[model samples]
Target: MAIAGALIWAAVIGTLIYATRERRRVQSEHAAGLLILWGGAIIPALLLGLLLGYALWLMPDIRPWSAPGEPAGLRIEVEGEQFWWRVRYHPADGPPVDAANEIRLPVGERVEFTLTSSDVIHSFWIPVLGGKMDMIPGRTNRLTLRAAKTGTYRGPCTEFCGTSHALMAFSVVVMEPDAFRDWLADEARPSPGAGAPGGELFIANGCPACHTVRGTEATGAVGPDLSHVGSRETLAAGIMPVDVEAIASFISKPDAIKPGAQMPAFGMLPEADIAAIAAYLEGLK
Candidate 1:
């Protein structure tokens, strides 16, 4: 795609350059003949037509979302929320695992990403990967990605969906097959109960009303899952690092850290209570 786009821009610029030169030059009768017209116009027309045709023909092979035996591979459902991402990993032989903000994938595996949106239109894009796909409400878009190397990559929303669009980002980690399998198993397992007021704080704060924490009483349907919040690489959809300080700042003044965030600030709480809440959330990993 990059090569094709560069070629197209070059053709346009070249046309403008030739036109400028013609305008400044002394035109003879021979310069305006049928042969000059053919060389200057018809030849370029035919070349552009062939170039576009070739690009179209290569599209199927470049992004084959429906490759054979794709069903046997890993399936992940990602929902673009107000300003975050809710991810579900479905392994080949186990129940789905819930996660948010961060994603993990195996190196050299063609994982099928089933994308959707909870509200408005969004776009999923990973620059190092292939292309971006639309995330439409009530509809699913599919994209396949196979990493050629093991590393961490960032993915940002290519579409402007809302006020906090700038902060709506996620991270992807590509690991070796064995490492990924182990991580997947660990992530898929249910989270252990945090016990006591730590659990109480999550509930008394009305967290369960919007988030879900496995192996606990907190079950909220409106926000992203908090079953493994501490394990994520970043918080507030990559706006801040996943640390106690960041979590505390987010809990106190969410919109300050991330403008236009949907989560309200907790400045009304005492400092000690806020620290306890942040500690509890950061200990989930």
Candidate 2:
């Protein structure tokens, strides 16, 4: 397209120079009318029409949505929150698995995603894998993606939904099919560290009212699931490292790290209790 535009510009300049140099000649009106009919209208119309057609031809490959009536074996539903992502995997042969902040996919397999927003508008975009799709409240959108290679990539909320929109992000881990299967199987199970001393403190501190740790008494659904938080690569929607200190710090004061976080600060808790809780969470894997 750039080359075509450059060629057209050169032709216009050449025509103008020729016309200026031949100003002494009395050109017929028929010649000017012909130039206007072809150069001004027909040529541009043809060029733009060809470009439009080429773009339309590439549309399917660019926005690779699932075809009608196609059977999608795996479906992932991602809900955009204020500053986090709620991910759920629905496998064809098993029950749905709930996760948060991170997405794991099998390379070479096409996966369809159902995206929506819980509060304001947000856009789901994994630039390495596919284009962005809007996630709006009370509306659902679908996008399909297939990773050709195994690697880790980052996805962000492209739309400005709230004060902490810049802090909202997620991780995409593409793995071999077998590895993805194994990982998903393990993710389906409950948290292994659900019986630790910190788990008791977590429940006692009213953490269960918002978060859920499978296999434990914490069954709240208002926030991200902590079933395998320690196993994930990052914390707080990929803003912090997944470690005891980060967890403790986030728990103590979420707003300090994420300005518009919905999770209230637990700074009043004893330092020892906070450390114990963070340790328990770190052992969730």
Candidate 3:
């Protein structure tokens, strides 16, 4: 971008200087026409054509390698929903680890993302990590990324999905290799202990039909997994900080937090019950 900007400014400034200084020197009408052809048309065309050719040569490599028994690198599947990201880490030894919104990857490793959409076309973009890839419904797209540094990067849904598209965002946390392995191991485990309030409520209140809290009987795969939901930094696709209060509010009023969210508002539940559910979810970590 800086190079392009410099070239554009250089062209504009050179034209301005030449027009003011050389206008009087060019006496013949034919010279002006020739100048317009070579300077105005030919030069800019060649410059732009070269830029286009370079971009085409450097187009982001997007080949879906998330299929079974493929690509020796770490593979992840991401499903784009209306206002959130459903993530799955394919592990060799056990069931796929289910997560939402945030992803933790090891630094200096090639990570392949298999992107798809459940409802609408959404673009997955983590600017500092790699190029953008579209997630189209019924179609799978892919992007291979390599993060050089260890830090948190923003992942936002670039394609305009719906009313809540602007709020659809996540975080990519790059950690050391050993740290990431430990984290992934931790993530693959089931929810620890019995969720007294939220566990029973989540099961009996029909929440299990859509969400999965591993280790318990709430193993529904329709929505984001809540096995480690309390450990996330943000709730509702980075809309708010993760806390028991926010979780309780989001549980009862998802529509209020995300205008076009798919989760139906559980406004009918009593405030105490909602708090209990939130408290239980908050302790999963």
> Best candidate, TM-score-wise?
3
Model 2 Cα lDDT, one tens digit per residue, 17-83: 9888946877799998999999999998998999999999967754546679977568899999989
Question: What is the model-wide C-alpha lDDT for candidate 1?
Answer: 0.82
Q: List the residue pairs that clash in candidate 1.
A: none
For 121-214, candidate 3 gives per-residue lDDT tens digits of: 9999999977799999999887888788999878899999999999999988899988988888888887574456567887878898888888
Which candidate ranks first by lDDT, i.e. highest?
A: 2
lDDT tens digits by residue: candidate 1, 1-285: 689679868977986787678466666778667646876679779878998899898676446356576466788889998799989998888888888888889988878889999899999988887789989999999887888899989999889998889889999888999998898887765555356356787778887878888777777767788877888888888778888788888889988877777788887888877888887888887
**Candidate 2 colliding pairs, count:** 0
lDDT of all predictions: 0.82, 0.92, 0.84
Please give the clash total of every predicted structure, in order. 0, 0, 0
Clashes of 1: 0
Q: RMSD, each candidate, Å?
A: 3.6, 3.8, 3.5
Which rank order by TM-score, best down to worst? 3, 2, 1
Cα distance off (Å), candidate 2, residue 125? 0.8
Lowest summed-lDDT stretch of 10 residues in model 1?
A: 188-197
